[model samples]
Target: MQRMGGASASLVLFLLSFSAPAAPIPAGFVSWDVTFPGNSGSFDITNQTGPNASTFPDTTFPITTTLHLSGLGLTVHFANGSTVVEPSSYFTLSADGESFNGSPIAIGGTNPLPTSATLTGTFSPVFITLNNGTTQTILSSFSATISPSAGTTLADGDFAIINATTTTVTGTPEPGTWFLTVAGFGTLLGWRKKGLATFRNLLERKGAL
Candidate 1:
C-alpha cells in the first residue's frame, strides 16, 4: 500500500510538471541593406510595425496593403561625401507586387547634416513572390533622391538602388519560458524514475519478482 501511494504521488507530480501553459513568442524586427550600382553610396532600413508578430501583413498575392511604419529608421550615405538620417515613413505595396511607392521621408533633422531634407521616389518591378508562405523578394528596384532644404546641397543627387536583400523577422521563445520548459522535463523524468523504482520494490516484496 505504501509503494502504491508513492507511485500515485509520483504520477501526480509528473503530470503537474507539464501543467504550465507555453509562453508566447515575441515579435522581431525586419531589416535590409540597400546598395547602388556604380555608385559609392548606400543605405540601411529597419522597420517594425507593431509590438507582436500578429501585426505583420499576409504576403498573399492579389492584395494591396499599406504597412504602417512604427520605429522606422533610414540612413542614407550619399556619394557626395554627405550622409543623412531619416525617421518614420510609410510605403505602399501594389496589388500586382510590381510597384513600391515610398512616402516622403524627412531627413537630416540631426547632426552631421543639420539641415532638413526630403527623400522621395518610386521603385518598379519590386516583384515579391512567396514560396511555401514565405516572402521571396521585397524590393527589386530603387529610384529615390534627396531634396535638400535651402543652403543644403549635401544630399542632392539622383540615386538608383541596384541591389537590396530583405530579411523577415520570426518570433522566438523568451528566456524564462525556455528555463521553465527544461525544468519541467527534469522534474517529470525524476518523478518517473522514482515511480518505477517503487513499483519494482513493491513487486519484489510481494514475491512477484
Candidate 2:
C-alpha cells in the first residue's frame, strides 16, 4: 500500500510539473526598411500603449512609414515626410499636387507581411475619391520594397495578415518549440517514475530489516 501511494504521488508531481504555464511574450519592436524610387528609409511597428487612444482591435501595432521624394515632378514640390499607415488598412501618397492612398501591396500572399519588399512599378489607376464619396480614377504609378528585421515572419497572424498573396519568407520556425517541450517533459516523467520505484524498494528493504 505504501509503494502504491508513493508511485501515485510521483505521477501527480510529474503531471503538475507539466501544468506550469509557458513563458510570457516580451514586448519588442518590429522594424522594416521601406524604399521608393530615389528615396529610402526605415520605420518601426509597435503597440500603442498610451492613454486616450482607441484600443478597438485590442492587439495591433501601428506602422509609421515615411518617404522623401524630390525627382518625381508635381505641380508643387511638398516637403518629404512620413505617411500614417492606417492599422490593418492603407496609407497615402502625394503626386501631381494631389494625395492618393493605397493599401500595402501584398507580396507573398493575399495578406500583408512584415518581410522585405521591393516595389518597382507605377501604381497606375489610383482613383481619388471626392468629398461626396465619388471616386475619380486617375493615372498613378509607384514602386517600392520592404524587408523586416530578424526573428520576424510575413505570416504571423498576430503581427501580420497571411493570405494567398503574402510572400514567403525564410527563418520561419517549423514544428514549433511546444512539441519539443512536451517531449522533454514526457521523458523526464519516465525517469522520475523509475527513480521513485527504486526509492520505494529501498524503503521496503529497510522496513523488513
Please provide TM-scores, in order, for all candidate models, with all chains considered together. Answer: 0.24, 0.21
Which candidate tops TM-score? 1
lDDT of 2 by residue, 1-209 (tens): 56456556555554444443322211122223233312322332332212212243432311111112212211111122222333312323424222233333333334333443332222222332222222233223332323333444322222212101111212222353345445556655766787778888999989953
- Residues 1-209, candidate 1: write the lDDT tens digits: 56456555655554444342322111112222123322322232222112212322542221122223233344555435675565444445434333323443333333243232333332222332222232222333232333343455344342222222333312233465456556556666776788789889999999998
Candidate 1's C-alpha runs over 4 A off are 1-172
* Best candidate, lDDT: 1
Q: What is the C-alpha lDDT of each candidate?
A: 0.37, 0.32
Alpha-carbon deviation at 124 in model 1, angstroms: 22
Using alpha carbons, what is the TM-score of model 1?
0.24
